[model samples]
Target: MSYVFQFGPILDRWPLFLHGALLTIELAAISTFVGLAIAVVLAVSRSFGPRPVAWLIGAYVELIRNTPLLVQLYLVYFVLPKAGMRLDSNQAAALALSANLAAYATEIIRAGLEATPRGLVEAGLSLGLRKGRIIRHIILGPALRSVYPALGSQFVLQILGSSLVSAIAAEELTAVSNNIMMETFRNFEVFIVTGALYLAMVLAFRVFFAQTNRSLFRWAA
Candidate 1:
């Protein structure tokens, strides 16, 4: 069958698509920040908490990591509502993505934490630094520096994965494109344009993080 390209019709709805893209970026930004905070705590707990606490955190990480994010999202969105704790689609998407991202980040940051040298930790102790102070000043920097690249790549991946939120009708970029395709009957063209938009967003995030790392990690210079 010959296919007709109707990109022009889809382009007419650019404003709706733009708004959806903005929502997606907002969701990603919130989730990334919240997830990173949770990850830092989990990572530190795994490294320094009591045995039982560490084991619990490890299990949580493994469970989340092994499961599919879509299943996780469904539990948060559909199942939670059935349990009388309801969340809107966007909020549920953000919560689900944040929890999923946290599991991965926990492992990433834990690896970074483990990479700290024993000698450097001892040096901090000899300088009369408390354990917390030693972890913050002596270990945190090198650990983050060692894993910043991985973290950056994960952040980009998270941005791309945000598209899945559309399954819940979150009206993100992909959701917007789907709507446009339905309205304009331009399925292929709309999707192609949306894919380009997603690519641009990912590239923008990469560049932003690259500059942020340069500014934040001057010691790495």
Candidate 2:
């Protein structure tokens, strides 16, 4: 009852919040796009590529999954500089997030591929289709469609996970919030608004994903 709340300082900084939020969205979108591309490749390779290649892909998936993302981010941002491949904070953040997302999505997609009936693949083969063609034409779409929901969920997690990128000073929503909190010294009010913004972003994306699922995969229903 004694704590008086003041939001004027936070509200006055709307433009900063907007900038930071847009950056957050950009980070998540880039990761989702890049990550999905990588996931599809890894999943297909692991499922149908040659044994040695598949084993390498499997090892990659397990390695990424077992490691903490913070470590991955550090390696990309900090360690790579020593190797003569330096990326700025945002570039590093995007790369790390994309790599992490790719691993989990790969597993989800693999499960979907497994659930697909083998007969369909056999049918494609009987038609003289190459195994690669069979995977591309007859297998990839259905396998991905079956797991779209899971992939979408992983993307949502990636958005939240992006908050962690602030550790490298990527200037995303959380990083911006921290800056504002330091200046305003209103940690309580600043975080409450920041949390609300995150919730709104997540909900908005969920709705978009739901509508997209309906339009894009309605045939699956």
Candidate 3:
């Protein structure tokens, strides 16, 4: 007997897949932007702040970077309850994803910040620009442009990693696929569809990031 391929069952439940795809996008978008914001702050603090602040931020970056993301997800969803703080699966997923991405983004942005030339900074100061103004107007643009490609790669990884949130019952793409597979017993078809959705999402993110890089950095040159 030969195995028969069937997609009819999977196709009938397109709505569920659509919902999962949207949820995946939502989770990735929110976490990536929030993570980037937190990463910028951490990088700036580590780069320019006092010694103690820098050390604390450094420790956080190391801790998150060294540990596994799954462990972090478990810690947020399972461990926090013992400390009297409880979060739902989706909330925990978002928190873990943001923190995870921030650790890596912090280092990427910090490298860009470090690569900034000292002469420009001095020139900005001589022109009476405030410290914050100098960073915002003079340093930030170039630094971001320098690291934008790395950041884009990280964002795509984050979007793919969102699939792991299903382990916490977050109802993301993977979780939704599991449900469909159980219902239809079309494991191959279901996973193939799920994988395609993830690929499409990653491609979309790449395009979005590319456009952003062009538009934001066009004036920097």
Error of 2 at 99 (Å): 0.7
Model 1, which residues run further than 4 Å from truth?
none
lDDT of 3 by residue, 1-221 (tens): 98899999999999999999989888988998999999999998899889999999999999998998988999899988778887899999999999999999999999999899999999999999999899889888789889998999898998788999988899688999999999998899999999998899889889988998889788865
Task: State every prediction's TM-score relative to the real structure.
Answer: 0.93, 0.96, 0.93
Q: Candidate 1 — which pairs collide?
A: none
Residues 1-221 of candidate 2: C-alpha lDDT, one tens digit per residue: 59999999998999998898889998999999899999999999998889999999999999999999999999999988778986899899999999999999999999998888989988988999998788888888899898988877787898899999999999699999999999999999998999999999999989888889889987778
Q: In terms of TM-score, how similar is model 1 to the real structure?
A: 0.93
Clashes of each: 0, 0, 0
List RMSD in Å for every model shown: 1.7, 1.2, 1.7
Regions of candidate 3 where Cα sits further than 4 Å from its true position: 127-130
Give the per-residue lDDT of model 1 (tens digit) for 38-101.
9999899889889999999999999998998989988899988888986899889999999999
Better of 2 and 3 by TM-score: 2
